[model samples]
Target: MWRDHLTQIIVFAVLFLGVSALGFFASRWRRTGSLDHLDEWGLGGRRFGGWITWFLLGGDIYTAYTFVAVPALLFAAGAMGFYAVPYTVIVYPLVMFALVRLWSVSYRHGLVTPADFVRTRYKSPTLALLVAITGIVATMPYIALQLVGIEAALKTMGLVGASGFGRHLPIMIAFAIIAAYTYSSGLRAPALIAFVKDGLIYLVIIVAVIYLPYKLGGWGHIFDAAQAKFEASPAPNDGILLNANNQLNYITLALGSALALFLYPHTATGILAGRDRNVIKRNMAALPAYSLVLGLIALLGYAAIAAHTTPVLKDNNTIVPALFDGVFPAWFAGVAFAAIGIGALVPAAIMSIAAANLFTRNIYVEFFARDASAARQAKVSKLTSLLVKFGALLFVVLINPQFSIDLQLIGGVIILQTLPSVGIGLYTRWFHRGALIAGWAAGMGAGLWMLYLVPNPATDHAHFGGSAIALSKLGLDTPKTLYVGFLAVALNLIVSTVLTLVLRAANVRDDGDDTSPEDYVADRSTERSSLAAVASESSGVAASRAAS
Candidate 1:
């Protein structure tokens, strides 16, 4: 079965091995004095500048799943999949306002994780611990979603085994390579490999959008074909054009996703790695260019329909890869597959590093090893990253890809609950720590309950059918659907507001904040003295104090 794909496989092998070499050697690219510190190992020394920041953040935002699953969702569900394009558009402006403050404060305080910032800002270890654990739990399934992208590409290339362990071995081996390099080079591995990954993705997307459209009888024919297919289908909301029932879902999903995207620890890991606030600002302005690319990528679903390409596997995630294999030459198809497979590595490495940093800085150091040295923290982070990656590997292997997508939807919902404390708290300390904690709990519980009630007929699952929740399910008279994250977050904000006022009236003691007003606006150059002083405070001392 693999004999016919030898050319494609060989080309993919060369590119894969080349990037693997780069990942292993990335530690030497920007030589820091030591990789013992969390700053050095977990965040690429926080010295990434304009172009590096652009590519790194781009790679972090646009994952293998973006290439595979977004198009797959478009192929399977139509207009709803285009939610990602607008979500990307909406996110940059939001980040421009929110993340610059976060970067300034994190840089000023020498904070390594979002939970670390939460701990200091709220002066409450318990609240920060919730933020840290949410980040880890939300991140694991996201990492698993990236593997789904790789699995889809491999299945299209006929590189996967027939069943059971044989089918999963390729995925495990790929992750092993990623885990090894990430363990050695840490964030630097992804930071460097992102360049190649994004380059290939752009090349493939640009060519496919231009060439495939012309070959498949242009955009008009593609849309007509997709529309015809959806119109004939029995599903009410699966058509090419957005209906009244789905318009709310589309808007809310896009906006909710935009808000949730930056809340994940990996997103912050990318932002925090920048050299200064200007690096973040400039990249935010320029990063919208990827949105243009993403819009084109989403249209590949329609293109696949126009091409009359059937997914090689039962999974819709394989639709784009199948389209490539059927239409493009074997060698070029190989390039496209390589783009996706390599794309997984960049985000997976960053995510595991982010999750591991959260575990090391927020949980392990805060609660378990108060006297742990810098080197000890780095060692723990490296090991934890390995465990996180393998855990994601197991998740993908054991569960279905459709279920993985549902979990990712739940992940966005789960991570959004942190906005009250992390994103909103960046601009104001108005939210009491206790209030924020209660809000997170309320939001999380509501989100999970909604997800549990959604049913996916395709997967024969009763819960976690999708991210869209029906208004009728929420006791509304209308049949319209909306993104569950948005509703849950709204509930969270209301609960937080009412509780903050009540707590203040009752004279509930606030956990006095550690951050000064000036800290929120401090930059790297302006805050050199403060950064130096904070850096001098050993991790052990900080952890011990945080614990006490």
Candidate 2:
């Protein structure tokens, strides 16, 4: 099998190496005066135009997981996997309202991470630390998910062994290349490489969607084959259509995931890289084109079933790669695998940069070095990105892939806890800082406990089985299942609301906000004055401390 796939391996290597070279050279793409500044190194100098922003955000959002795991889930479960499609669709309008405001305020205040905004909004270092830590923890498994995508591709090409050191050596090597480029180029690396990654993915998906259906008879036969397989299986809920048992899970999962998607630090990293609020608004309108591509890609799960392509490693993630290998020519299969591999790089780089930015801005700057300069912050951020990527590598090497998936689901749950503080706090300061912190704690605790009780029989794991919880598990007798994140966030809202009222009535002091109402509406052209003012204040404070 390895010898037969020599052509595919060659093609994958050429494309992968080509992108790594591009990533190294990306530092010079925009030709900044200084790469030492945190804004330049961590955010591509915040100058991405409409088209660049479109491709960068598209690449950041539609990841290798979209290419591999979504289809894998579809292949294994049927209609339930299509939740990603609706989730992507639901996320755009929501972010259109939410992120534009976040961009304006971040640009105005020169904030580098969501936690930076949280700190300024609440004037609470502890709350910001919580937000920053949650972001870093949530993002680690997500980065591991990307590595899982590349591992699936490598496994499909027979480049890695079934177990032991051989299995992880190739993954580590790939991560090392990513870590090097990201350390050098930071956000620019991913923004530049996204063009190639998105282009290859578009080409591969276009060909697969058009050619595979015709080759396998038609879409009709594809669905027919999927239904036949599900019917023959012993599983109770395995058909191509949604049943009453899964209806609530489908709706709640889509809603919860959509709410949590942009809350990830990587998504905010991409959004903050835009040149202005209009760049964000335009990208929001245009970025949905990738969702259209995603809808078509989801059909490949059915295509895999129609082709009767047995997964290579008994892993569902291998289903898509195996489908390409079975249906397409060797060279084209190689292209598909390369697309999946390179797709991992864009999001991995962004996620690491985002996590590093959170650590540098929120933890380091806020706690250790309140007087740290931009150059020093950038240095810390660069080193932190390398550490974050290696942490993700350890996650992939040490944990079961299914467990990583569950951890990512819990990540979404954890990240959603921040919406009350970061997302809603953008518009209103009514929720006290103490209330927001308590709310986050409630949501995170409930989410973890719920995930711990759900069991996966296939893996024989008694805890952290999956994101879906039976309604019966929550004291209802029905067999229906719902997303754990949604239920957790509901409890989060209740706690925050009740606490906000109690705090207000007790005359508790909420930290005064640093931002004004006008800041949320500020555009790039109007933001410089505020940025300059903040910089002057920070310098003065540093000098005063030095004099003392």
Task: Please give the RMSD of candidate 2 to the true structure.
Answer: 5.3
Put down candidate 1 lDDT per residue, 12-124, tens digits, no spaces.
Answer: 88898899899999988896659998899998899999999899999998987688888888888888888989999989997796899889999989998899999999999
TM-score for each prediction? 0.95, 0.95
- TM accuracy, model 1: 0.95
In candidate 2 the C-alpha lDDT for residue 496 amounts to: 94
Q: What is the lDDT of candidate 2?
A: 0.88
The 10 consecutive residues of candidate 1 with the worst lDDT sum are 398-407
Residue pairs that clash (backbone atoms under 3 angstroms), model 1: none
Q: Write the per-residue lDDT of candidate 2 for residues 272-335, one digit (tens) a residue.
A: 9899888999988888788889988888988999999887767777888999988899999999
lDDT of all predictions: 0.88, 0.88
